[model samples]
Target: MLHAFRLAAVICAVLPCAALAHPHVFVDVSLTLRYDAQGRLAGIDEVWAYDELYSLLMLTEAGVEGTVDPGQMAALRGLDANWDPLNGGRLTVEPPDGPAVLAQPRHLSTQWQGNRMVTRRRHALSPPVAGDGPVFVRVYDPTYYVDFAMPSQVVIQGRAGCQASLQSGQTRGQDDAYAATLRAALAQELDRAGPDDVQVDIGAVGADSIAVSCGR
Candidate 1:
C-alpha cells in the first residue's frame, strides 16, 4: 500500500501539468456518525464508491474480473486490511482542546456496485467522546492525489436533534494552485521522505467538510 501511494505521488509530482490537473481516481463518500446507548460518540461509518476506471483496475489486479471466488474474496480483504483511511491524515474530528485521531477501522469490506467498488468500514474514535457540542469531520486527500467528495448529507445516529451539513472548500483556482505547490514539494522530497514521513494537509483541502451540531 505504501509503495502504491508513493508511486502515485511520484507520478503526480512528475507530471503535474498533465496528471495533476485531473485526478486519476474519484470517490464519493458518505459518513454516518454513530453513538452508544449513553449518547456518547462511538464510531464513524464510511462508505466509499470508487470510480469505474479504478474499480476495473482493482478487479484486474485482483484477478477476479469474472467471478467472486475465494481468491477474489481474499484479495478484497487484503485491500481492506492494507488501507488506513486516516494514515495520510485525510480525516479529522474536532473536540474541545484538540482534534481526535481515529483508530484502525473495523468491519471493513468491499463489494462491487455495477462497475464500481463500494467500500464500507467503521472507524472508532480512540477514546469515546460526548456527542454534545459542535463536532466537525473533514475528509479529503491532502496530497490531491485522489479526489474525494460527499454526495449526500452526513447521517447522524443515536443522537437526537443532531444535524449535519457539508461545506465546500477552496475555489477551483485556489485548489489547483495548492495542488501544484504540493506536487512540486513532493517531487523534491520523494527520495528524502519515507512512506511514514509523507503527509497530507487535511486542513488545506478540507473545504468540503461535514459540520455536525447536536442540539440540546
Candidate 2:
C-alpha cells in the first residue's frame, strides 16, 4: 500500500519559462519504481506529479478496473466534500502506447491516524512492467458520454522538457477537438520529460522547456 504525501503548502508552485506560445494546459507526474540489485521491483515510491490533472483523474478517480468509456469527466476543482478539497478527487495516467480511450482512475483518501490526517491511495498501475511505454487515457464525463484529450506532449521551451496533456470540461466543447489534436501530437515534438523534472504553466501556450531528465 503506497501512501500519498501532501506538501506543507497550498500553493501550486510553477517553474518559470521565457516564452508562452501553444503550451499544453495540464500537469505531468513521475512514478519512480525502484528495484533491488536482482531487479525485483522493490517498491513504487515518490511520484512527482507535474500538474497533469486529467491523467491523474482518469487513473485514480475513475477506477479503470473494468470497461471505461472513451469519454468521461469529473469536475474536482475546490470541490466541497468529505475530506480536504484536494484529496476529494483523483488522478490517472494510462500506459504508453495504449489507446487514448483506456484510462485507470486514482482516488485520494485522507485517514485520521492519531492526531494528524494521512493521505493515501492505490496508484492502480497498468502494465506494471518497467520500461513499458506510456498509454493514452480517455478524459471523459460519466454524466455525459462526451470525451476530451490533451496532446500527448507540450514542449516547455526554457529547458526543453516534455509534459503530459490534461484538459478541462469533459464534453467536446468548441475547442476540445483542437486540444485533443495537440495531446496526440505532443508525443512527436519531444520525448517524455525525465521523472524529476518539473513542468509548470502547463496551460501557458509557451514559456516552458525541459533539459531532458530521466523520470527515475
Candidate 3:
C-alpha cells in the first residue's frame, strides 16, 4: 500500500506536462473524537475508504483478487505505515490553546468493501488535549496528490455535551458549485511548473475540517 504513492510519484515524473493535476486518488474519511475518563481528548479514530480505482490498484499490487479474506486483509495493513513526517500522516489536529502536533499512525485493520478498501487507524495525542475550546481537525495531503472527502458529522465518544461540525476552510460562505470550480482550478495550478525559486503557497483552499467543542 505504501508503494501506491511512490507509484504516483513515478507517474508524475514520467508525465510532466500531462493534465494529471493533483488528486490522483480520492478518499472518504470518517472521524471519531475519543475522550478519556476525565473527559479530555485522548485521540482520534479514523476510517478511510479508498475509491474503486485506487482500491483496484492496491489489490493488484498486493496480488490480490476478488474479495479479500481476513488473512489477505491482514497482509495489507500499514498502507501509510511509513509516512512523511512533514505531512504528519496527512492529518492535522490543532488544539485551541496550544500549537498543533503531528501524529504517528497506528494501523488497526483493513477490509474489503465491494471494490473499495476500508481501513482503520488510530492517532494518540500524548498528554491529551484538555479544554472546552474547539479542537480543529483536517485530513489532507500537503502535495495535494490525494483528495479527502470529509464526513458531515463526527462521532464523539466518552464525553457528553460535546458537539462536532464541519467547517469549510477555504470555501466557507461559498456555494457548492463555485467551490468545486475553485478546487479544479487549484489542481491545474498545482500541476503547473514554474521557476524553481518561486514557491506556491498551499493555502487551505479545499481542505475540509471538523471542529469539536465541549461544554460552554
Candidate 4:
C-alpha cells in the first residue's frame, strides 16, 4: 500500500490540481491493546484492510492474481519492506505523560479477505509503559496522503480493569471541508510554484485515534 501511494504522489506532481487534493490510499484498521500479566502496556496487535483498488495494486505488485490461496497469502506477508520510518510505520503510541517514539512493527502477516487485502502486525512497546493514565494509539500519515481510518474494532487483553475507547477525528463531513481547504491551498501553491516544483506541507491535523485506560 505504501509503495502504491508513493507512486501516486509522483504522478500527482504533474497531474491536474484535483489529483493532489486527496489521499490515494484508504485503509480501515482494527487494534488489540495488549497488557502483560503485570498490567503494564506490552504491545498492540493491528490489522489493516485496504480498499479494493489498493488491494488489487498490492496483489499485482506481488505477482498475484485472482483467488489468492494460503501459500500466496504467505508469500505476501513481508511486503511492508517499503514502510517509511518517518511515519512510524504508519502508527504510534502516545503515553499520557511522555514523548512517543517510533515503534518497530513485527510478526508481519497478510491475507486476502474477499476483494480486500488484510495485513496484520505487532508493535511492541519496549520498556512497557506503566501507568493508569490513558494511552493513545494513532494510525495516520502526517502528510494526509494516505487516509487511515482509526481502528473500527478495539480489543483489550490481559488487563481486566482496562477499557478502550475510540475517538474519531475526521468524519466524512469534516473531511469534505478539509479537502476543500486543501484544494484551494494546492491551487494557490501551484500558482506560485516553479514549473517543475510544487510542494505543500500538510500535517496530520485531524487524525483519529484510540485511547486505553487501566485502573491500578
Give the per-residue Cα lDDT of candidate 2 at 58.
39
Global lDDT of model 3: 0.68
lDDT (tens digit, per residue) of candidate 1 on 80-193: 322645432256688665788688777667777677777887889878777785777876665455677764587788878887877777636435655555554566465655
Considering summed lDDT, which 10 consecutive residues are worst modelled in model 2? 1-10
Per-candidate TM-score against the hidden true structure: 0.75, 0.23, 0.72, 0.72
Q: What are the runs in model 1 whose C-alpha is more than 4 Å off?
A: 1-21, 69-71, 80-89, 171-199
State each model's C-alpha RMSD to the native.
Answer: 4.7, 18.5, 7.2, 5.7
**Is 1 or 2 the stronger prediction by TM-score?**
1
Q: Which has the higher TM-score value, candidate number 1 or candidate number 3?
A: 1
Question: Clashing residue pairs in candidate 4, if any?
Answer: none
Strongest candidate by TM-score: 1
List per-prediction Cα lDDT, in the order shown: 0.66, 0.28, 0.68, 0.69
Cα distance off (Å), candidate 4, residue 169: 1.4
Q: What does candidate 1 score on TM?
A: 0.75
* Model 3 poorest 10 in a row by lDDT: 194-203
Which is the winner by lDDT between candidate 2 and candidate 4?
Answer: 4
Candidate 4 versus the native: TM-score? 0.72
